[model samples]
Target: MTVIVRDLRTEDRDDAERFARSRHRALPHLLWTAEGTLHLLAHTPPAARRRALVAEADGEVIGTAQVDLVHDSPEPGQGCFTVYVAPERARRGAGTALVRACEEHLAAHGATKLFAWVLDAPAHRAFAERHGYRAARHAHFLRLDLTAATLPPLQPAPPGVQLRPAAGFADDPRPLFALDLETAADEPSDVESGSAGYQEWAASTWEHPMLDRELSMVALVDGVPAAFSLAHTDGRGRYATAMTGTARAFRGRGLAKLTKNASLHRARAAGVTEALTGNDGGNGPMLAVNSWLGYEIVATEVRYVRELG
Candidate 1:
């Protein structure tokens, strides 16, 4: 059987569903949906030069890749591609074909450095090394059984504080945008990503289909948005915390835990059965908060880097 790589058909719903299915099978810890897939394709900034790729074998998609340049980063010539093949279809040449296509696309766009997140399994790590990539930072995917875990009881807000849902900001989401920008700038990563403009953030994050506005909890300190937990639900009983952080000034008050715990509790009440999140291995504070929330590490992935000649 011949495996061929091609660009994903953005206008085709069937194509998007197939792509999302392959990705979900390869990485089960994260949430994926066809609508979310299309949102990324349509909402990504033009400068990103994002390309959605798929590997077809016997008239079916067996692997997928999201390739793009780091447009918001201050540094130039940096790009990334995350490629994954369905677990049941491994070693069928689909993965290698998709990787070659991803590299060609990024390099053509002036990428001097390329990075990828490879699963920490032995075979996955060996595949990255064979492709001339070296492992760098590690991260973990954490899971919580929302339906079975004993969640902490909800508590009243502390003095001068209030817990609100992100949906309350629909009339004007600029405050959430500002908070997200500040926290994202401080997130640990191998590549330094700069902040996105309000318009960009709205399109790529706030307005995305998967963002669960009602379930995402935000903390208000004297009416100012200080901390928030961004939630994404797949409409299939699966929910993930896209990001959870507190403003710099509110760091020591345990607001991060406060917001996330509220979000998870509401998510369970809303019929969400599983909760997922990811954290950089070096981010001890967030990791600790997840631990307090009863999250357990389910899988790990390492960021691999490759430099072009």
Candidate 2:
């Protein structure tokens, strides 16, 4: 029997949800939803040429591949395809078929360099190496059981400091942007992420479909947004700590932990059962914070990059 790979139909909600579920089981770190998966297909820039491809076996969706160009980067011909098959369905050629279709589509659009993230597992890494991708940066996926873990006690904001929810900035979020840019300037990553323009950040972060502003905690110093714990939820009781950082000028004050704990407490109180977060392998301080908050290592993923000729 042969696997049939084709573009996903927006009307096929059940099939799309299965694809998303397959990805979640394979790699739980990523944030994905059927609505979000479909949104990307509809809203991604034309230059990106993004699409979601599903592999069907006996009329059942068995795999998903997200193919797109690196349009945000200044470089050209940089395409990427992240393929995930139901773990139980591997070795049936669904992964290979998805990758082949992605390569053909991107190559036709002038792609020479491709990037993909593979788990550090022997089999997954071997699969990527077989396809010419070399390992790059590695990151960790951490988790905390909100209902059972012991969270750090809240500390009163030091003199002149305050703590609040990001929803307070519903009218103006530029201050939060400044704080984000300041903290992101030093975030550990294989690919140096640039500061997205404020308008774009508003569109991508503030207006993102999954953003939970009420759960996003922000630390303030004399009325200035200085640190924050950005939160995202899947609307199904799963919470994720997206970012926790303090401004460079305020680094040693422990404000990041302060806001993060506040957010976590709020999440647990609001019925969020499981919380997820990720830390760069080399980021010791952030890792310590997560550990202190009862987050444990659940999985690891390695990033792979291939240069374009």
Candidate 3:
């Protein structure tokens, strides 16, 4: 059977659903939905040169890849690509085909360095190495049984600080965007992202289909947005923490912990059965927060890097 690689047809609902299904099967710890997938395609900035590729075998989408340049980073020529093949379709060469197509597209866009995240399984690591990718930083995918696990008791808000849902900023989300920009700048990662402009943030983040503002928690210090936990829920009882962060000045007071815990509680109350989150291995504080919340390390992935010739 010949496996053909082609760009995903976002306008085709079936194609989008198949792409999301492939991702869900390959990485079950994270949430995926057709709407969320389409939102990514529609909102990607033009300068990013993003492309979603699918590998089709017998008219079935068996693998997918998300490739794009790091547009917001100060450095140019940096690219990111992640490939995933449905578990049942592995060993069919779909993964290799998708990766090759992704690399060709990225290189044509002036990408000098490419980074990919590979599941930490032996076979997955070997496949990346064989393709000239070297393992770099590691990250963990944590899971919490929101329906069964006992979460920490909700703590009273600190003096002068109030825990509120992100929806409270519906009229004007600039404050939340500013807080996100500040925390994102300090996040531990290989790529350094410059401050995201309001228009960009509105299109890509605030308008995302999966972002559940009602369930997302925020910490307000005297009416100022200081810390927040961005929540994303796949209409199917699955919820994930898109991001959890605190402004620099509020870092030491456990506001990050406070916001995340409050969000998780809200998620459970809303009938979300499973909660998922990811953290860079070097991010000690976030890792500690997840552990304290009874999250288990369900899976791990390592970022692999390769330089284009």
The lDDT of each candidate is: 0.94, 0.84, 0.93
| Model 2 per-residue lDDT tens digits across residues 14-113 | 7668778878876776677887677567666677788889899998878888998877666667888788888888899998898889888888899888
Against the true structure, candidate 1 has what lDDT?
0.94
Instruction: Enumerate clash totals for all models, in the order shown.
Output: 0, 0, 0
Cα error of candidate 2 at position 268, Å: 0.4
- In the order shown, the candidates' Cα RMSDs to the true structure are 0.7, 2.1, 0.8
- Which residue runs does candidate 1 get wrong by more than 4 Å? none
User: What lDDT is reached at residue 116 by model 3?
Assistant: 98
User: How far in Å is the alpha carbon of 296 misplaced in model 1?
Assistant: 0.4
Off by over 4 Å in 2: none
Query: Which residue pairs of candidate 1 clash?
Result: none
Worst 10 residues of 2 by lDDT: 188-197
Error of 1 at 34 (Å): 0.6
TM per candidate: 0.99, 0.91, 0.98
